[model samples]
Every structure is written in C-alpha cells, then in structure tokens.
Target: MLKRLVSAWVWISTGLIALIWLPWMGLVWLFTARDPGRYSVGRWFRLAAVTVTRLNPFWKFRTTGVQIHDPRRPYVAVANHESLADIFLLSHLPWEMKWMSKDTIFRIPVMGWMMRMAGDVMVIRGDAGSRMRALEEARDRLRKRVSVMIMPEGTRSGGGELLKFHDGAFRLAIETGSPVLPIALAGTRHAIAKGSWLVGRARAIARVLPPVETAGMTLDDVPALREKVRTMIAEARTVLQRELAAAGA
Candidate 1:
C-alpha cells in the first residue's frame, strides 16, 4: 500500500515535470538546434528523468566503474535490459550517450517530444528499412564522437536471467571501428514491471566495464566479440548480485 502511494505521487510529479519540460526543450532546441551529446541540454534532460528514480524512497540506485575520458572516442554502449527503471539508472552515467529508443516511445505525447528534442534515435522494429535508417543515425552520432547506447537483449529479461544477446551492437562497433562498452545491471528486474502500477523496492546498481577494442575486428569476428561482451557483463552482474546481497538488498 505504501509502495503504491509513493508510486502514485512519483508518477504525478514525474509527469508534471515532463509536461513542463516539453516547452522548455522546444525553446532550447530552437536556439542551439539541439546541443551536441554531453552538452548542457542533454544533461538537463537526463537529470529530469533521474529525478523520478531518486524521489522514490523504495529504490536505491548506484552506478560504478569509469567511462573512457577521451572526448574524441566514441563507443557502442550496450547494457542488459531488466526494466524501465534501468533507463533512469543509465541516465545517471557521467557522460551522455544517444539512446536508441523504439518508435512507439517516440510516439507518446510530451515524453516523446522531450526525447526528440534531446536528440535520441528512434528505431522501428520489424521494419528493415527503418532499422537501417536508425542504424545510420547511430553511426552518425558515433562518428561525431558521441556514443550510442543499445540493449543487446532488445527487451527486458523479466526472469532476472541474461537473454540471448543480439549482434547489431557488435556489428555496429566493428563496422565503425568503435569500441564496445558493456554495462551490467543488477536488481532492476522488478523495480517497475511493464504492466504494473505498484513500484517494487529495489537496490539497483549499474556497473560500466572497460571497453573492448574493435580496432581490427571484422564482420567474421562479430560472433566472438558478442560472446566476449556477454560473458564480461554476466560476470560483473554476478559480482553485483553478491554486493547487493551483502548489503541486505
């Protein structure tokens, strides 16, 4: 009962903020033509979402590990998707990365407008052409020295187990000669289930691992590269689970 009430209040505040931010974003976009990645505009948008997760007393979120500091280095950032809450945790990362969101998300009202103004890429599933277009956009961002983020699993693994990783992110890394950055997420599976209104108490942690260089990798090396990242994330997730357990989470 308490959790539900907190969720209700949080959603109200979050929605209100999103509604207000839409116009603000539009005004800003008009001036800067949407600032580049990791700029003030994008960071403000990320923090807006972080407000929702932080205001919830029932959830504890933390992000560990360091990102590459080279301003000219871009990577294909991939993470294991566990829940929508995972997004909030990701926004907590120090630098900004372009989110490869689904088309349906970009079709929403105020929320969608904010995402667009913030320069996120929209991907339409099952449409090969749309996917290709989205990939091109992501590639463009990477070339601009801005990282692109994708979930290799494509969807949340509700059972709290790793899913079969896809090859798109790997292919993107190799094709662009960008490194692959793996982020392992733990304790987010039940934070906010897809079809539920009640928020679950969770201790979520996002661990960003070192980048796997793909300087000379080719298409034939994608399979091996994919497994290598998945394995690294899996091991990190295991260690995070232990840490959460040790903390009584």
Candidate 2:
C-alpha cells in the first residue's frame, strides 16, 4: 500500500510539472527550432516520462535490441499493449516515433497538449472516417521520415497474452512501403495490472526486434504480415518473461 501511494504521488507530481514544462518547451522549440513537429521536441517529453518512471520506487524499466539510429529509415513500429506503463517504458527507446493514440487520450489537460505539440496521431475508435484520416496522417509522417508506433492489439490485454492483431497497422505498412518494426514488452502488466489503480514492484522489459520490410507488399498481404509480426512479438515476450523471472530469482 505504501508503494502504491508513492507511485500515485509520483504520477501526480510529474503531471503537475508537465503542465508547466510542456508549454515552456513548446515556446523554446517554436523560436529556436521552428519545427514544431520535430522529433527532438518529442525526445524532451519522452525524457520527462522516463524520469517519472525512474522516480517511482516500485518499478525498474529496461530495454534492449533498439536500433533506431537511422533517421532516414522510418518504420511502422508495432507493439503489444500490456498496461498503461508500457507507454513510459517504451519511451526509453533511443529514437522517437509518432504515437497513434486513442482520441480520448488527447483530451487530457497537459499530457494531451504535449502529444499534439509533438505531432502524434490520434484515432477515434469505431469511426471509419477517423481511422482513414489517421492512416493518411501516419503515411504522411512516414514519408517525411517520422516513424509511427501503434499497438496492433488496439487495447491492453488483461491476461498478458498477445491479443488478436488488428489489420490497420499492417495495412498502413503495406500502403506506405515502410518497414514494420516489431517491439515486445514484458512484465508491465505485473507492474500495473489491467483494471487496477494499484502499482506493484516489478521489472519491465522492452525489446525491439528486427524490422520486417513491406517493400513490394500489397494490401492482400496484410493478414500474413500481421500474423508474422504478432508471432514474433509473442515469442520475444515469452523470452523476456523468462529473463525477468531469472533476474528476480
């Protein structure tokens, strides 16, 4: 219970800090960089998130296999959704990507404003028009050398199992000719369980697998591509869980 309280306090304090920090950074980026959509600004926000996660006493986050150095090679990065903590953990990766988040998240006060300023894409669930626009926006970003990250599961899984993958991300990859980067996350569900507010002590692992090229691929290949990435992540997730268990032992 005390750990949970500490976690809650960390979130509240960091959120309040973000309310002040985001706008100031925005102003600085506007004057100096003149690129509001630049990935560097997004890196600043991600650093703040990593700091918040580090400050929390109940969690230890680690990442591996991230080869995001090449800015010229933008990808359609897909990952499994385990918990809300996955966001902070994944942000630890060295490179920045435009996140495809649900529209409701964009309604939050400071965080949402930061996301918009960072040029993250938003989608309305079950809205066909919104989905199309989001995909179009994602393609545009990829064309401009900005990688886009999506959770193909669409929502967090309660059982920590790989949920059935969605076709939207795969379709986007095929349409844009961007390589599909498969990312696997483990132990986040143990850190902050689905449908629960309480936090627990856990180590989270995020692994970035090799990019699956979509070159010469067409829409008809979306189903196979989706399944292939999904299987890769599932296998990686299992390995990560084993490593985490051994580390704890």
**Clash totals for all models, in order?**
0, 0
lDDT of 1 by residue, 37-87 (tens): 534556567888888787888888989997567745788999998888888
- For residue 170, give model 1's deviation from the true position in Å: 0.7
In model 1, the Cα lDDT at residue 85 comes to 85
**Please, what are the lDDT tens digits per residue for candidate 2 over residues 79-166?**
9999988988999998888999999989988888888877789999999999999999898888778889999899986666789998
Q: For residue 32, what is the lDDT in candidate 1?
A: 71
Colliding residue pairs in candidate 1: none
Per-residue lDDT, model 2, residue 206, is 95
Model 2: CA > 4 A from native: 32-37
